[model samples]
Target chain A: MQNHKTLWQIFAAPILIGVLSSIGLIAALVGDGWWDGISWLTLALPVLLYFFFVLRRRRVNS
Target chain B: MLLLCITGLPLIFHHEIDDLLHAEVKPAEVAPGTPMADLDKLLANAMAKSPGQVPHFLIWDRDDPNAMFVSVGPTITANPVNNRLVRMDAHTGDYLDSPDVTGRFTYIMLKLHTDMFAGLPGKLFLGLMGILFCVAIISGIVVYAPSMRKLDFGSYRSHRPRIVRWLDVHNLAGILLVMWTVVVGFTGVINTWADLVLKMWQFGQLAEMTAQYKDREVPTKLTSLNSAVEVAAHAVPGMTPSFVAFPGTIFTSKSHYAVFLRGETPVTSRLLKPALIDAETGKLTDSRDMPWYVSTLFISQPLHFGDYGGMPLKILWAILDVLTIIVLGTGVYLWLRRRKTGVSTVRAIAQTSAVEAPLASS
Candidate 1:
């Protein structure tokens, strides 16, 4: 098995990102009209965060 | 997989792009609450200019104060590809403009996407493509089950090689999106062959509803379009009119106006406005919810296109669609890599598994 940090590096980030995005998506679907703008951010935020997490993890692992 | 990825991506965003681009589309002026008779007169005047063709459908803009569009075609025919468009002043029914839409981008893309632009051949090819796409999706799911069986849902084994890493991502996306993708794909298949589908549905359920009317006195003096629209509106109060098919069209008997209304609710958005007016009396002859297949068509549109929740929903659809593209690309990559490794790509899963059983089972 890999080190705990490596495991976190490999899994936690993506899982967290997916869960966060899913929440935002469901909220956008069922949320009040006032929260509409935040919905787009919710969809886009995960993709951006995932990229950052991957790049930062790569640097640290090296 | 390739077909679904390509076709599904555009479908997912069709609403977004159409809305963004349609802002430039200038709507013709229409008089509010114009009587159905006057609207019919206006349509007649508009059709008089287009001489050789008979009117098919009349669309009034619910939002635009003075805008109406009419589609006309050669008499005694019902092919979607061969129709002509005429825009007129809704209040006066005077022909304002008739853009030569024979080879426009929108029409071209629609034709290509729906039927491959080969007419019957194109439609048949697209039908085949839809079938193949469905098969690919099923096969993809079959392939996913074994791999996903070992790993937890959404799990990604990143310690594997690049190909395996990508493969896990592909599997996860595919399995998660399977239900949505299948819904969209099946509906897309139904839509691509809508003319046939509608006919089949109509013949099945509508045959009973229309059986009595078939023998009734068919009136030569048709009720004006204006009255018919009014009668339909009266039947379904608060429903917004989507479009109205004039008499002598496929949507209705030679003596009726079929006004398709839309409900304001999310559920109603897919159910559609259904009011059939007598051809001669311009009065409501029948009003009811759409038949099952028609309702299926109605609801499938927003679900397939992912246009339900507005801009945010569209953005989410686009991202998911892009991810799907990546998954498709990775699948192709894995196949190519296996080929490079001297495995024949044509082998059935069973045969391939037999050979690579030792490798894959591990």
Candidate 2:
């Protein structure tokens, strides 16, 4: 069996993404204009990541 | 949880859908500096159309500055839940069509999303489910660690068996959406307590604010609604009126008009401060920032609705919602698959991570 990954290795990306998502959620609530833009970008990260991995896997398989 | 997600999908675009489905009377276009029509005139026009119905609330349409809505019910003491909204042009005081929105598609979706057509008990039950959903997300996170012990983040084994692939998808999606699901879910739970929270405000802060006039009867003659609004605005300098709860409504005392004013900042805009005006005298009775619980409800509203950040954010919200649906779908599939094979969830997760384990055929 492959060496077991540390908890940090497993959770590092998720924790970062969670922090970004949190910032995104609160950004738009603080103000509009650039604040809203920041929110849109930050909140879009996970969704973008999801698509990236899924489509990448599909492309690799094909 | 699945029902909440499915119903919530359409609600994310409820406004856009309502605009497309319903033929609404558009407010007339006017110059930027054009003064808003007198609130009294607007109230008069609205009441003229609704005859015996009493106005419970006057609301400024958040999306449309040129239009306002007067919520009217059959009687002063009647429940405002079934109130008819009379849309009036802000500049001209013209009566716009008040379509029976309760019969609309978006309205139906909203009813289902909120309470499953089961009233407060339904709302609380759904809230209980939301609590469980939150707990599930947390426990999912805990199990996620063990599942990922042998796999990298975002690892999708496309060549694996259906169950294994699905387990990966569930883990990937669920972990990625942890913050969003928890925030949205917890906020939804908070939103379920909105009615109760409003009741608490009424009995707590609202009652305290109007204690001196507790025994006062509903005013026989109401002062000019326009002046009362002006009084409220002047009382609270930096904030603008969000809505006005008319005299004898649940939001205010029988003898007062509760003008709920909001600030200019996005955050403060959600946090409303009420300036109660004497209905008979057209003077500010009391003005105070809403208590913490009420403020929490207000803040939770936009967070749950995903309406605060404009179109792009709403689109993102829809996508995230869809991702959540996938996570839920895969989760159920994994559970059923485990049940069929008589394998524990943790064991399945652990086995799926180990490539040397014998491939389990579907």
Candidate 3:
């Protein structure tokens, strides 16, 4: 069976990475505490999204 | 170029790597409200370490109070690279004979990443490589558009040949990394030209800052180092100084001390605003935000280093850096893979169909 990704799945990586990086950037400029927490989450997001690529392959293999 | 950026991965977490190696010199944590160490004593202690040298700057870490970094050189006008740095115990004024972090592997990686030990020419060559990298990124995007228009973004086909699978993943990763790669690339290139920007700042902004004091006799009797810092801090309320440049240092005016203050917050901390103060009087002489070029250089620092955010951001940068290496490697692989494969599968079929259609019509 062929793997056909939805538009959301296709666009997910760039959108999440770009938007979160922007958010992280904004949060950094907004100062610390809550802003720092937001910055950390947003900046760490693309790395987390990467795991989706891994899990999808694993599911297909199993 | 791939190797250079790959080497920079460890450099992204240099503080952590350095801390792991030199745990003892991590600046002993002191009890809260502990009387801060005296700057003058620290200076005397530091000078004793290297006699016959006049210190260029007295630096106290805004975040850590346990140690001081005192830079000294042959003369005040010497280039900063010629200066020797001595770290002193801020509390007890004790000199720690420790493994220098600058001599460690991370530093080597930094040298490899920045200049390959070739100095300015090497840096400029790397800057050229960075521009090429930007060009590659732009071309890669344009090249991927037609293929990606038909296939959904990130459509990696595993059942296909190995090269094809790699090709698909390469495009996916390349597209994902476009923004990040471009931003980092531009910032990295800008960072390489830092020396030039600083020299320009000295030629223009610093000249303007010290214009009135030009041709004036160098101040002989200096006031309290602590007092100059206080005056600078007072000039910009609620902000602490990052470093103090003594009267003769390149950063300071001839007759005034340059007390550079920084905001405690993440954003403002990257920007260092210098408050010029009278060397003999400890009075604020001039205070202004850094010029745009210098500020751009400072802001590019966090984007290039990825240290501004935290450990998590560094990890993210490392991951992306790895992916970028793969993208670069696969790009070469695909170009090579085409050598044996001849024309692309789509183009081959199109050519065959063109001939077949003519025969059928005849």
Best by TM-score: 2
lDDT of 1 by residue, B1-362 (tens): 45545555566565445556545345444456664337767878787888888778887754454667788888635674577778777656677777775555555555556666667666767767767767887898666555544454455555445765667667666655454455556666766676776777567654554566776544656667777777888899999777887665667655667898877655564577668887865667777776767876766666556666676677667776676677678778878877787754323333544666588668
lDDT of 1 at A60: 60
Q: Tell me how many clashing residue pairs each candidate has.
A: 14, 0, 0
Predicted candidate 2 versus true structure: per-residue lDDT over B1-362, tens digit per residue: 99999999999999999989988989999999999999999989999999888899999999999999999999999989889999999999989988899888889888899999999999999999999999999999999998898888998888766877888889988998899999999999999999999999999999999999999999989998899889889988988999999889999999999999999988898999999999978888899888999999999999999999999999999999999999999999888977898988667656755645554432
Model 1: residues with Cα > 4 Å off, grouped in runs: A2-62, B1-25, B28-38, B61-66, B89-96, B119-162, B215-220, B342-362
Ranking by DockQ: 2, 3, 1
DockQ (Cα-based) per candidate? 0.14, 0.86, 0.31
lDDT for each residue of candidate 3 in B1-362, tens digit (9 for 90 to 100): 69767898898887778778766555556777666566777777777888778778877755456777888877777876757777777777666532454578988898888888888898888989999999999898667655554565556655445666677778877876777778788889998998888778777888898898888877777787777777788889978778888787778777888888888777788899999998877788888888999999888888777776666667777888887888899888877756667977445434655766687689
In order, the Cα lDDT scores of the candidates are 0.64, 0.92, 0.75
Q: Candidate 2: global Cα-lDDT?
A: 0.92
Q: What TM-score does each of the candidates earn?
A: 0.73, 0.97, 0.87
lDDT of 2 at B39: 91
Q: After TM-score superposition, what is the CA distance of residue B212 in candidate 3 from its true location, in Å? A: 2.1
- How accurately is candidate 3 docked according to DockQ? 0.31
Give the runs in model 2 whose Cα sits over 4 Å from its true position: B345-362
